[model samples]
Target chain A: MTARIGVVTFPGSLDDRDTQRAIRLAGAEPVALWHKDKDLHQVDAVVLPGGFSYGDYLRAGAISRFSPVMETVIEQAKAGLPVLGICNGFQILTEAHLLPGGMLGNDHLHFICRDQKLRVENADTAWTVDYASGQEIHIPLKNMDGRYVADEYTLDKLEAEGRVVFRYLDFNPNGSLRDIAGITNEAGNVVGLMPHPEHATEPLIGTGRTDGLPFFTSILKKLVNA
Target chain B: MARVVVDVMLKPEILDPQGQAVQRALPRLGFDGISDVRQGKRFELEVEGPVDEAALARIHDLAESFLANTVIEDFTVKIEEVAEAVK
Candidate 1:
């Protein structure tokens, strides 16, 4: 059976189509979900693509965290649903408390856009099972508010629990705590990251390489096995 | 009616990049005496009708959960003014 992956589109979403395409490329059916719709349509998994949701008003992803659909997403995510939040979506996850930490303005006060390299710190998550531990992959990163911050205790807990799923490599693009690019919840089902893996999933577009194909394939494989 | 004002600021431990940029630029602009600049958000809410202690508590909760992210920020709420007792 082909897995059905849902991609949510908020008002300012820019990469929902790309994420759905990536899901299709991984042999899964892509379901278009609306920000106002609470029903997920029984999708095997969900992906929140990056964009300036709610115009990044008040704060990036701040207002969108309270969207009607997010109410269901948060509940399902807590119930061990496989959810991937990319960039702005990651901001929403944090704002909704589905994940730890909050994002702030880049340390240099500039919007950074680059092909970022990340090391797979913990490949045991529902979204990263295909990547080998400590393996490095390049993905595009673009955003203004991408610096992740958290309390010291929370940071230590994330590190101790091995929940830091991805860490920046070579150079820390933003001043994220401990160079963290992505992280997973305790159940390893919900993952949030500040990079655009969907943009790099296609060989023709991923800077001429398919480094981010593993993310989509990994989730599809998990759905198939379960 | 009552006016509620909530102020949210990044925790001291967390880095404030925007605030830091302003601080650094201030020196370049010949304002070197200032130090430790930080930026934050302020929300002013106007509640309808007379706000009692219960309403105050609820507003506090709203500020904590929505107006501020407790993970890396702190918030303070003040009921600025209460409605005059009407006859």
Candidate 2:
């Protein structure tokens, strides 16, 4: 059976179309979930695309955290549903307490746009099973507020739990601790990343490498076997 | 009424490349003796009513959930009673 994956669209979201396309390319049915809608359309998993939601007022994801759609998402994510938040979506997850830590302004105090290199640190997560542990991949990372921040205890806990799914390779662009690039929840279902993986789904577009496609494929492969 | 001040900054475990860049630039720019520098922000708020405890708690939530990134930064919420509110 073809799995139905939901891609949420909040006000100011920009990459939802690409995410939907990536899902389709991965052979999964993409369902659009509006920020105002309460129903999830009975999808198998969810993806939160990135953007300056609500003009990024009062911090990047603070306002979006209070949206009606997030009310349902919070419930679903807590129930162990596979959830992936990219960039600003990552910001939303943290703001809603679905994930830990916070994303701050870029360390350079300037917007950064580049193809970032990241190493897969955890392969057990639903969003990363397609990639081998320690595999390195490149994806677009463009954002003004991309610095990841957290306390020592939380950082150590994430590392100890093997929740650190991705770590920046060679260089850390946004001043993230321990070169961390992405993370996942304890259930290996909820994952969040600062890089724009949706933009890397197609080969002919930029780097001609579909390193990001694995994220979508990983979830699809899981649903197929389940 | 009382006033509170909050200070927030990224934890040392997290790389502050910008801070390092600024520090590196300072020595070259002839700003000698400036050995260390870490960038951060501070906020102040005033609250009225008898719920000083509640107001302080709310401020901490605001700092943790919004103002500061608990992942890389720890925040200190300084709550001080600024004489009492006018009757």
Candidate 3:
């Protein structure tokens, strides 16, 4: 059976097609979910792609977090549905409280776009099962508001519980606390990261490295065996 | 009708890069005696009808849920009457 992965497209979404293509390349059917639509169409998993949703008004992801589709996404995610939020999607997840912490302006106060190296601190999450623990891989990271911040207690809890799934390896690009690049919820079903994995899934494309293919393949494999 | 002002600011513990950039530029621009700077957002909401408890409560809810993210920022809501001079 082919796994159906839904990719949500918001008004300002720029990477939804790339994310869908990545999923298709991984042998899964891509479902296009709209921001205003609440129905998920029974997708096996969902990916919120990157972009400046709602023009990043008020705050990045602030307006989009309240979109009709996110209402269902949040509920399903809490019920253990596998959800991956990339870049702007990560911002929405934080704004919706589906994930902890909030993003702020980059420490350098400039938009950063580059290939970022990250270590897979925890490979057991629903979206990272294919990677070995402590594996380092490069993915494209881009955005203006990418610095992640949280209360001290919350940061300590995330560290103590091993919820920090991905940590910046060589250099901290955005001044995120403890060099965190991505994280997973306590259930390990929902993951959020400020990187564009879809852009790196095809070697013939921009970076010419398929380091991000495992993210889609990992989730597809999970759904198949289940 | 009443004018409600919402002020949102990052928590002191969190780093404010925009504020820091401004602080650094102040000295270069020949300004001194400024200890620090913190950037924030302010929203002015114009509510219709009486400025009663229910309306104030609703505004508070908006500030908590949408106007501000409690994770790294705090928000305060101030209710001010319309000055007669402006009217």
TM-score leader: 3
lDDT per model vs. reference:
0.91, 0.87, 0.92
Judge candidate 2 at residue B2 and give its lDDT.
62
lDDT, candidate 2, residue A199?
89
lDDT of 1 by residue, A1-226 (tens): 7999999999999999999999998889999999999999999899999999999998889899999999999999999889999999999999998899999888888899999999999989999999999898999999999998888898999999999999999898889989999988889999999998998987788666788889999999999999
A42-103 in candidate 2: lDDT tens per residue? 99999999989899986788888888888888999999889999999999988887888878
Over 4 Å off, model 2: B1-87
| TM-score versus the correct structure, for each prediction | 0.95, 0.80, 0.98
Which pairs in model 2 have colliding backbones? A149-B71, A149-B72, A150-B70, A150-B71, A150-B72, A151-B71, B1-B85, B11-B72
Best-first order by TM-score:
3, 1, 2
Rank all candidate structures by their DockQ, best first, as comma-separated numbers: 3, 1, 2
Return the number of clashes found in candidate 1: 1
lDDT of 1 by residue, B1-87 (tens): 678899999999888877887888997899978987999999999988767888889989998888888887899988886668799
Query: Scoring model 2 with DockQ, what do you get?
Result: 0.44
Q: lDDT per residue, candidate 2, B1-87, as tens digits? A: 667889987676666666777899997898999877787768877666654677779888989877775655779999765765589
Regions more than 4 Å wrong, model 1: B29-32, B81-87
